[model samples]
Target chain A: MKRRLLLVSNSTLHGEGYLQHCQQHIRDFFGEKVTRILFIPYALHDRDAYAKTARQKFQSLGYELDSIHEAPNPVDAVRKAQGIFIGGGNTFRLLKTLYDHNLVSEIKKRVLEDGVPYMGSSAGTNVSTVSICTTNDMPIVCPPTLTAIGLVPFNINPHYLDTDPNSRHMGETREQRIMQYHEEPDTPSVLGLREGSVLLVEGNKATLLGTTNACLFIRGKPATQHEPGADFSFLLTDTN
Target chain B: MKRRLLLVSNSTLHGEGYLQHCQQHIRDFFGEKVTRILFIPYALHDRDAYAKTARQKFQSLGYELDSIHEAPNPVDAVRKAQGIFIGGGNTFRLLKTLYDHNLVSEIKKRVLEDGVPYMGSSAGTNVSTVSICTTNDMPIVCPPTLTAIGLVPFNINPHYLDTDPNSRHMGETREQRIMQYHEEPDTPSVLGLREGSVLLVEGNKATLLGTTNACLFIRGKPATQHEPGADFSFLLTDTN
Candidate 1:
């Protein structure tokens, strides 16, 4: 069986009781076959809080806990598991730990090469890009050189929403950023995920789940929207 | 005398009567002794269109148009004039032509090496950067390779605006591209300029002229807003 790549996107999981939602994405993507669920217990002020929080959510999904994979070596922790559940926290902290342990290679092996069912929400999607260019976070928490797992060529901007009137941010709204990406490269599509949106990429095909408000940016321009329950697929021959 | 740079940002020159406003900035920055004007007809659609456009705008500026300066040689064009005016049409077109003619190296000598006063609006500013990656045009116009005059390091994204709800664009916001730029390099700040806004880089200073909504990004994160009239001298030293 081919390893499934489930890229979950919901940024509100940082101490917002949103882990339950993250677990649902995991259950929805992978069913009863997921024996043990492992999470990187790194981001919290208290590291142990992540395991307890994730276990509670995992139990809610009607799955018995085989073992909770937690360690400095995310690659090793993930290798021992059948399905990996990466909960959300500050993208910076999680990325910093990943880089320090040099676990990017092993994690990529487990998911892309070894065919381990990989599940991640929020920062999980962020770590798949070449660099963390689209996250709504400051630069203080981690080194700028700390990039993602390079799952796709483009960056993943999770919990994306257009700007509201009261927001005083001078930054370009979510829509504008994707448009700019279209102007940069017209190939690798930038997936703009709203809450509850899931992009499942198996081999070269990517499908949009949840809301269709999600968009795709090719290079530095926006291509078009992927309607809900719609599938987005491209062949390797088309990309090069 | 040091070489001078005039940043005029009017896509539609006389639209908001910003032409006169831009001219005032030119006079203020380059001084009143600018007699002979070297018009870079490079920004116009064709040499014929370039001549006509130059003739019209020169008449509007209250100066007796002595010569059209329609020479394809940017270096020769600079030698024949006391001052220059780089008009706007499509920045990508102007940049492509400059890169194609190998005249960019000569133009750089006139502006950066020599003390010639260089003035450019819209497309002209786009040519000042090392590449035209940040201009406000469709990326459909692809030049084989980008080589700007190196008047500035990072790409200068001019004619920038905040998204309007009524607008019809489905691309990534300009901010998103700038943020993505940070993931690649923590240097090179993306300068978002609105109409009537100008960026004056001299010695080691980049002063903002226009509204207070200008933004700067570093390491894939939004920095702070730079208010107009503030001396942005730090723009020069804040890079690799």
Candidate 2:
């Protein structure tokens, strides 16, 4: 597998500007090799505004960004693109638009076959995994299926949060929700990517990037946490 | 419609025991006429343990509770049920189990046609609405469809949370989510039921019960808050 992927937990940290926290990682990942990035703004509602935000951010990093929504031919755009970046919003709407535009396989081919560097944040990150089953977004719109572009073999729970002991809300915590996901048969292990974290995959080797720790939830096993710079390459071959 | 439903926002309050906050509402909804309550423990994984907890709670309220999982014939149990109560857990798991058992239409018949008293908490309350699209749950499992019991014309977002002004989390707030839900074509209005809140529908009249306020999110209109005693009967007839 010759895949170069950057799966970010979130685009913005608490008080920071858009893509401020992960600026260095993005810069180093793209470098001078990839000059232009085709941006998928389908996850968000306003494509123009989302594209503008991403363009301004990428411009500061010495790269050009083109939104797929404005392209005459989306599939052609993916085929000729040097890199891909999908920003985050509602996952269902994103997946549905991807299907509507018929760009899932094209994007997969560009990354997996052509070795195009791929970057996704939040919902964009969620759709890059095995399935969107572990996403925390609401099903505001029904997509044809929860099946996503399987750039990675395992599922990802992005923007993963720790249970607040002080919270009085009765909704299931992030940990409990992932535990429930494991109850379903044939489900893959989930990587809980906390905010400020990124899972960078270069070929078969995957490394955990950022300041916080990432959690791994395997079926019939207790959820365990791993610190930054941890090797998650086993996730590529281990589907269980 | 002769439906008598109690759709609670949550089973347990922040600091209270299970079903403790809505004890009086549950009791008055059934009264002396309905002595037995049929419990659906499918939302949770451990049927036996969920049944035991519900049995103990209803027993203290002077009603005998029988879990449907223990019934010789689950559909038959619904036919003879004097009242129905569904406990909350994962909404996806609950809907999938309901489809597996082919109990969607049967439960609908018991509630709408026979006027069997129905009560639901959290996920239970979500399934009782138009669809489980507004539920604040992870899609751990895939159901055949998102279409639910439709005991109410509109959808209900249980465990509806107000934005925490103090929190640093970047995840979408409850308001932004429902606004996204409204983006879909022909989607019904959504009622955001706060913790310690219950929406009681008796015959044609729907009353907001409990101490906290319920919010109505109508498409294109701003979200508005309603008091505890406010009549939501219009929600039934006005499906727009």
What are the lDDT scores of the predictions, listed in order? 0.60, 0.93
Error of 2 at B45 (Å): 0.6
List-wise, what DockQ does each model earn?
Answer: 0.05, 0.79
Predicted candidate 1 versus true structure: per-residue lDDT over A1-240, tens digit per residue: 254767777734333465444455567776877756666654333556667766677777766443233454455666787776665555665676677777677777787776777666777777765555565432224333545777665566777665677743333456655454344334355567766677787776667765436766656333566676676655211351
Native contact fraction of candidate 2?
Answer: 0.77
Per candidate, native contacts kept equal 0.00, 0.77
The top-ranked prediction according to lDDT is 2
lDDT for model 2 comes to 0.93
TM-score of 1: 0.54
lDDT tens per residue, model 2, A137-180: 99988788889999988999999999999888889999999998
Residue-wise lDDT of candidate 1 within B1-240, one digit each (tens)? 254676655534323443565566665765657655767665543557666656565566654343344455555665666766677655545776666666677777777667677777777887776666555542223344455677766556666656666633323355654554454433466677766577776655668875435666545554666678867666555663
Candidate 1 positional error at A99, Å: 9.6
lDDT of 2 by residue, B1-31 (tens): 7899999999999779989999999999999
